[model samples]
Target: MTADDQRTAADLLDAVGPAFGKLRRTALLEVDNPISAKDLSRTLVLNLVLEHSSHSEVTVGMIAELLGSDPSVASRMVSDTIKAGYLTRAASQQDGRRTILQLSDSGRDLMTRFRKHQRDAYDYITADWSEHDRLELARLLVRYVDSVAALKERSRTKEGDQ
Candidate 1:
């Protein structure tokens, strides 16, 4: 990569975590939803359940692994979200004895509004940018997320072997 490209990469690495942390901490997190999440972790649990439920059943154990937290922490977060009416527990189809998590109807609505708030924020932030530049940034952001997911998977596998 060129020196400019190297510098840009470094800058991106430095900015991503703080930017996302701030975004999650923003008012947009509530998104004027009827159900109020206790904190950022509640929202994260909802998002994680939504993201993983398509291909895998979500459970407290899964959330703990994904969040890199103790199972007790994830269990408490899940329990709180459940009490807030954003998540529900059900028996896993594959294992009747195992419990899985699913988003409540209200949780789905919150996510829909959350996505809209996110898009509005992105448009407002990049209002001065050209369409091509905006699209490129969107693409790059998704790519970065995919890269992080891949790294997480690899790390999980390595941990399993030890």
Candidate 2:
């Protein structure tokens, strides 16, 4: 809460920004299957679909809303994913006018590897932490993430009211 504490936190973030970039590069490089950064965006779209959708089916509109992307952008990414054999789309049974997307086997395989890389990254980041400290950090991180999400929601609501 003090000015010194605020400055130290800001300084830490500035110092860690490049470290975060390096870690992301390292993790992406560690993936078993090679995927270009450009291609990874579509893969991320498919991953979100798997994470949030039920029956393994997601609509373009749903993806757009979840990602805060335009419907056209989500549609294009879906098409790209399908072409890459990471996802497939079918006519929605509930609503014939809408399309539903499902992740293909390759997509699932990629996600598995991605998860492993993420675990490794987290492990590396916490290598020096004691068990108790690790647990406390995890708890704090969860709370921080939740608070940020709530703040984002409040900001959106405030914007809407203006």
**Which candidate has the highest TM-score of all?**
1
Which ten contiguous residues of candidate 2 have the minimum total lDDT? 26-35
Which 10-residue window of candidate 1 scores lowest in summed lDDT? 28-37
User: What TM-score would you give candidate 1 relative to the actual structure?
Assistant: 0.77
> Alpha carbon lDDT of residue 107, candidate 1?
86
Q: Cα lDDT of all candidates, in order? A: 0.82, 0.75
Kindly report which residue pairs in candidate 2 clash with one another: none
Query: Per-residue lDDT tens digits of candidate 2, residues 1-162?
Result: 655466776787787668646854666655545456765576678778886676445788888887898999988988888898888888888888988888789888867766776566566667797889777977987797689779978998999999
Off by over 4 Å in 1: 1-17, 27-40, 157-162
Poorly placed runs, candidate 2 (over 4 Å): 1-39, 55-57, 146-162
Candidate 1, residues 79-129: lDDT per residue as tens digits? 998998989999999999999999999888877876776777677768898
* Candidate 1 Cα deviation (angstroms), residue 39: 6.4
